[model samples]
Target: MAGLSTPKQKISALIITYNEMGYIEKCIDSVSFADEIIVVDSYSKDGTYEYLMNHPKVKVIQNPFENFTAQKSFTLKQASNDWILFLDADEVVSKALQMEIVETINNPNACEAYWFYRKFMFKNSTLNFSGWQTDKNHRLFRKSKAQFTDRKIVHETLEVDGKSCILKEKLTHYCYKNYEDYKGKMLRYGQLKAKEDFYKEKHFNYVLMLIKPLWKFFNHYILRLGILDGKKGVTICYLNALGVLERYRELKRLEKKNELAYYLVMP
Candidate 1:
């Protein structure tokens, strides 16, 4: 009894969604290897909930939409197990990744959290370089050591207090449906980012707004060797630059509104 290792630990695969009918099935199927699957839907009107209603292994809960960090944190609390594997609706865990995840949780080492490399695919092409080549996310973690940061609205950070590990297998990300879809998401993300910064009392500087976007394009495309990935690489860099521009524009708009309100009240 003293020499034996601890028993295999079960994992709870957690996903948060809102009107993700198209991608939900594939996402869930990828993580079927997990002991339990918990989906916290934000009242999806597009039949996303109905599809998961009869699943035996899945436990679905309908909750209202909140910020990204809050929604994810709430889902973490609903998990029945200590281990959590968070997945976005549009992403798919490969078979190799599934096996690796099973192995890691079954006999976890000293690490309390693990990071996975994400491979982004657009259309039929997978961009291997475009500054996204090094994209790794902290998805698998022990619930006791991990929590989401509340400071940001768009991209939330997972704070893990213990040692971490990285797996070589990748999680396939079907990020954008089309160029239009990509632009739409960028616009929304930019606005949310601007609001997040504005609420933090970050002042919007006119000079930095113009310089930052241009520098972003140059740094990602030229300095990061994104130029080698060809057309998709260029597109990715350009869109990233555009997102920076939009964020500053939105921030300026909010500042102007507040200034006008102050003047009106003073007179």
Candidate 2:
């Protein structure tokens, strides 16, 4: 239901990827209409490199693995155009969104950036009523005018200093391949968040750990009507809640070690 400006300017699509073999073809094919395609890969161990090497419109660059925010900032810097759309390997350009993007690029008036809603896909299902429905990300923008603020480690957000517009089309996102990958990602992301919070002196409480997971489940499943998606909703909610639990557990360990053991036990 969001509205703003019409598409009227040329766009350069940019992506920072790693081990995207399963999804790269679709990602590239979806954005073929872009004026330029720039991919900064994090030395993928998979066949992603071979695929891009054969792609005619794509320009690939090699980079060592870095955190999401830093890698994206570096990728944008490598892109050789002004207007850029930041996309992920597992994300697909929907037909409606593609049309809107073409139109927007052809006739951009007063907006420098555009935000789009994501339709996250779990296996073969899309949860419409989950908290994910409110998940809108700033993806398309004038590269020179947008930058990421260094506030977050896991869900790094961007800060833009220009007029913006909201596109109605949803971007298709394949979040995880299976349950195993989901759990592994949760553990890794929890470690990242815990480290960041540790530096900021964010203390942890047992009650907060227990309550936060429950709140996440309630927020995603009940409040967001994830119940509409049936089993998919349940899986998403449960995994997300578990991830939150892991984050708090890791944070607590950090606090205990740094605050209590380091000064007293170690010394």
Candidate 3:
């Protein structure tokens, strides 16, 4: 007599993309183990949408871009399986991580969500320090037990309703292609942060604007020992500091615009 075999749980891999043609194929390939791959694209002009559409394994959906949380929330609804593996277009799953995910999901007592640490890559180099040393996120979770925090605009956060544990295997995150690419991403994040603050009615502080960036540079470059990474570290620290400055500047601009609008409609 033999014991009954338990069926392995299926997983739906979800990805969000915009102008990610260069990385989407590799990203998709890495998660081939999933039962299905769903991509929510934001009207990419770079043929990324076309590439996804033609892929037999991927189900592509086009949605208007709002915030990171909204875009991810839309993708979550398209999953057919209860177990979801959410990945960014710029990230790739390693073989070990893929195997670990399969094993974890198969267990009857597995946690509701799994956290994956990432190895950051910038310009083909692996970044060891500069505050990126502990980069991690919850990528695998039960769809029913997880939801995106609506208030988070840029750095979207997933709220899991049940237990969670961190996995040992790491995903590789190709963070930036070049200096310009990194700069553009930072600026976009800054603007999004400002928009989030504006909606929350948070006033801009000039003193913090001046102090924060300086502290950011010092924290990452000196306190975090980013100096060991050399020029790449310096560039990252500097750009991130500039992003902090830009966030406050954009917030101030939004405040002024709101004031002008209020004056125009005065009774």
Candidate 4:
């Protein structure tokens, strides 16, 4: 055990979970390299909390359901470790990533906060196409140095106060179990995004409704080589198109209301 580095600073793994019973155990089991693991559960009705109770290193915090940003910030505050590795219930740290975490801490002239390139797995295929492969997330950082941006809606990235490095390791994301789940989540996210647009006076525009979605599909499926993924590729593109259509339709209805309000005020 001579080479076994006990390490000086404590690294805590932080995860925010809801009904993640199915994936929680495996996700926590994979990141056991850390000194402590914190699970902030939103009072799930499933076996998630119970499982965490039985888990050796798992520390469960019961908080009522809140937005993602607030929940994560709250958990970060509870962290006893100097550095925190943020993980989702559905995300798993690969072996390479685990080593990267340890080495990054052991080495800071080397890192401020580390970013992970996610490989989104859809069904049996590791989707290299579909704008997803280009997506990178900040999954590791010092607790005091980074914070999740306070956005009411989804698609938020963690804002770090210092310089960062991109880890060469890939973090596997088991996001969206099946096509139905993917479709449902996309539609829900579209509605949330549309609402944000509505508040910002970003109501229906001819270009957005008609052009932007088509561009997204073409960019992902055609130009991005999603066609290589075949059926899954086509499905991902079509779903993007559909989500856009739904968002546009939602915005269009609000646009008409704005026009009507303007006319009423004029008279």
Candidate 5:
């Protein structure tokens, strides 16, 4: 008698996008190995939604703009498969990663969630340091076992209910195209972080505003060995430090506005 063959495990690739016209096509193509590709777009005006809508392999859903965690949570709910491979619009999964994902999900003893390390790219150059060397996130997982945390606004965190393992293959993240793009992204992240802090009732410290950025620069440029990456390293480290300062500044602004509102209500 012939041995019985196990059924192949189906994987759903989930992506959230907002005006990512330039990178959406390539990102979707890279994840073509997935059984289904679900894209939840935030009403993209840059033609990202239209392209994904027309693509036969993609299932596109349009949602209103919200915080990162909320948007991702909405996307997760649309997946038909138990195994989820969450990807960003600017990120690409290599062939090695595709094979590894397939093999891991097929294994009976595989963990509930898997962390994927990333290779950060700035323009055409691959950044080896500047605190990005150890970049990783839990992108592949069993949907029933994981959900994103509710508090974080900018850098969303996944809360896994079961065991997790890190994958060997890396995802390539085309992070920033130019200086202006990088600046805008960092500033927006800072603003969102400030809103999170405000809701958490966290007090802003002037000392932190002054000292944290300096420490950030030192930590990235020196302690993290960003110096080895040359001028690109310096630029990235400096901008990152500025982003920290911007977060505190925005937080302070929120606090001041709140105080003004309270005084206005006082007769």
Candidate 6:
């Protein structure tokens, strides 16, 4: 028999986008159940603007992309309801998760934030391991109790004031479609992280550059049980390790360039 009907609750689904023409429609469709959906676009040159502007169910706010944390924080303030559900342009909300979110928002159970398990997809296959299996992110939270940190240029994290609980359902992440896309994103993220480390005066050591990648591979593939995922797992591990190595390499390049050199008087 079907379970009792879940109580309705007002939820605002917030999405940040930039040139995500391919993924925007599906992402929006998955959260049609939400009370309101707001898209904080970063002024895309592509047709993303045209498509989103036409969607009746979505409200688009074009803003310049400064950083991940700031863009997300701005999106949160646009939400009308106290309950906010944050989603990326390439992520989809499963049917079970939608129901679970509704129920949780209606009946808080003494929690201010809720986390969702994520299953990443690669080459059209659901990657069950390679450190991706255990991935979880805090996406749902009460606006009053949650805040985002601006410490890093990328990989920003959320801080919730009260207790948090994890939901049973999972969210689907379409992280990369092909090798080119993966490589491009890796390079871009590596550069951003390198800049962050450089600005923060983090040490640039040759030994760390060599060993850290190896550690990342072993930690994710061996300790985290990523080997069980086969070729897909190896590929994920390799990319992760490569990302770390490249960051240090980029950091070293920046260090030698010397930011203060621009102000020096040349002979």
Whole-model lDDT per candidate: 0.87, 0.83, 0.93, 0.81, 0.92, 0.87
Q: What's model 2's TM-score?
A: 0.88
lDDT of 3: 0.93
Point out the higher-scoring one by lDDT: 2 or 5: 5
Tens digits of per-residue lDDT for model 6 on 122-199? 867888877776789998999999989878778878989999899889998988677776777777778778988988
Candidate 1 pairs with clashing backbones: none
**Which candidate has the highest lDDT of all?**
3
**What TM-score against the true fold does each predicted structure earn?**
0.91, 0.88, 0.98, 0.83, 0.96, 0.90
Q: Report the lDDT tens digits of candidate 4 across residue range 44-158.
A: 8788988998898899999985556678878889989878888989888988889878888877375669888998777545877777867888888887788878755456568
Instruction: Flag the better candidate by TM-score, 1 or 2.
Output: 1
Over 4 Å off, model 3:
none
Q: Model 2 residue 246 lDDT?
A: 88
Question: Residues 1-267, candidate 1, lDDT per residue (tens digit)?
Answer: 579877888999999988787688889999898989999999988999999888777899988876788899999999989989999988899999998888888774647999989998876578777677888998999999999999877788899998889987999988756797688777877888888989998878999799998998999899988898788878888888899999999999988998999999995
Error of 3 at 255 (Å): 0.4
List the candidate numbers ranked by lDDT, top first.
Answer: 3, 5, 1, 6, 2, 4
Task: Give candidate 3's error at residue 106 in angstroms.
Answer: 0.5
Candidate 2 stretches with Cα past 4 Å from truth are: 1-8, 256-267
lDDT of 5 at 68: 91
Clashes of 3: 0
* Model 4 CA deviation exceeding 4 Å by range: 1-7, 249-267
- As for lDDT, the candidate ahead, 1 or 4, is 1
lDDT of 1: 0.87
Question: What's the best-to-worst order under TM-score?
Answer: 3, 5, 1, 6, 2, 4
- lDDT per residue for candidate 3 within 101-145, as digits (tens), equals 999999999999999999988868898999889778999999999
lDDT of 2 by residue, 3-44 (tens): 976544667899877888878888899999888999988888
Candidate 5 structure quality by residue, lDDT tens digits, 66-182: 799999999999999999999999999999989999999999999999999999888888999989888899999999899999979779999999899999999999987788778
